[model samples]
Target: MELTPEYYDKGEYIETDTGNKVSRKSVIHGSQNIILGGKTIIQTGTVVRGDLRRSGTAHAVVIAIGKYALLASRSVVRPPSKVYKSIFSYYPIKIGDFVHIGEGSIVEAAQIGSYVQIGKNCVIGRFAIIKDCTKILDNTVIAPNCIVPSFSVYGGSPGALIEELPECWSQVMEKNAKIYYSMFTPK
Candidate 1:
């Protein structure tokens, strides 16, 4: 998946006390401004741009990820960009726990709640607020500034609510995330 294999071999990554397995192959800028809660897997080819820091704030974390969040291969998780009062700026991207972003997805969301599963090759637009227990199918393109309600299933070019998520989705998502973390091994 195009990760820096040497880091895994050399064990250079700081394996956090919370069991976060971050691949060295992932392009993560501004490490100090990125917070990974625990048990988060940053897979190969994932690009998390924390260097696009918020304007005028040194302590602002560009990306704050919660526990058990999985960023799959080639996924790009960047802060949402915008032009504010004639100045271009990038806002922080907050991802909640148990959120699974699939391979090749691009997420520039304002917030992603817990137990959300974003399918492969999806494009989550800027300022999109995705709530808990939601599933976005493959190749879906969510529009900017849209709010995705909880317990919903969304898919399409401009993302539409297709159905309601099952009541037990939270448990299922959590279980899957845990399994993925447990099974991950560097080659």
Candidate 2:
């Protein structure tokens, strides 16, 4: 099989000992506010905004991505923001292990649980809490404060629950994410 230039793209990322590959081209604002677990891949053109801090907290974390998580190319992962009683604040984005966020998607959710698969061009709104083992189909627009349950497939504008996931969904996500993480080579 012929691989694309992206696959062979060397010297464009910083690979840690735990196999976390973060692209040099990706924009990570306030790196101190971002915590990445092991084996996480942040692809080229991905933007992680951590400069938006919470109210009254100078050193608050903005994005906490879990182990074996993959942030695909051109995706933007930002903390969710809201106005509370005339006060504006940004909440942390907590993504669990084995999560795959597809290309061009914008994630502004408060929490995304383990084994979640978010497809391309999706919009995860502010304060949306996505439970474990959920699959979000392509082009879906999840509204603010939506609580997505576990083992379900969510899609479409406003993000309705479309179907139920199989019991082994977590295993499947783990397998695929591991494979993807292993495919990256050191530049």
- Candidate 1, which segments miss by more than 4 Å at Cα? 1-14
- lDDT string, candidate 2, 33-69, tens digits: 9998999989899999989887565677788999999
Residue-level lDDT of model 1, residues 1-187, one tens digit each, is: 1222222443634467878887778898888889999999887889999888766756678899999998988999999989989988888889999999999999999999999999999999999999999999999999999999999999999999999999999999998787767666544
Clashing pairs in 1: 3-25, 4-25
- Among all windows of 10 consecutive residues in model 2, the one with the lowest summed lDDT is 1-10
- Candidate maximizing lDDT: 2
Candidate number of the best TM-score: 2
What TM-score do all the candidates reach, one by one? 0.90, 0.93
> lDDT of all the models against the reference?
0.88, 0.89
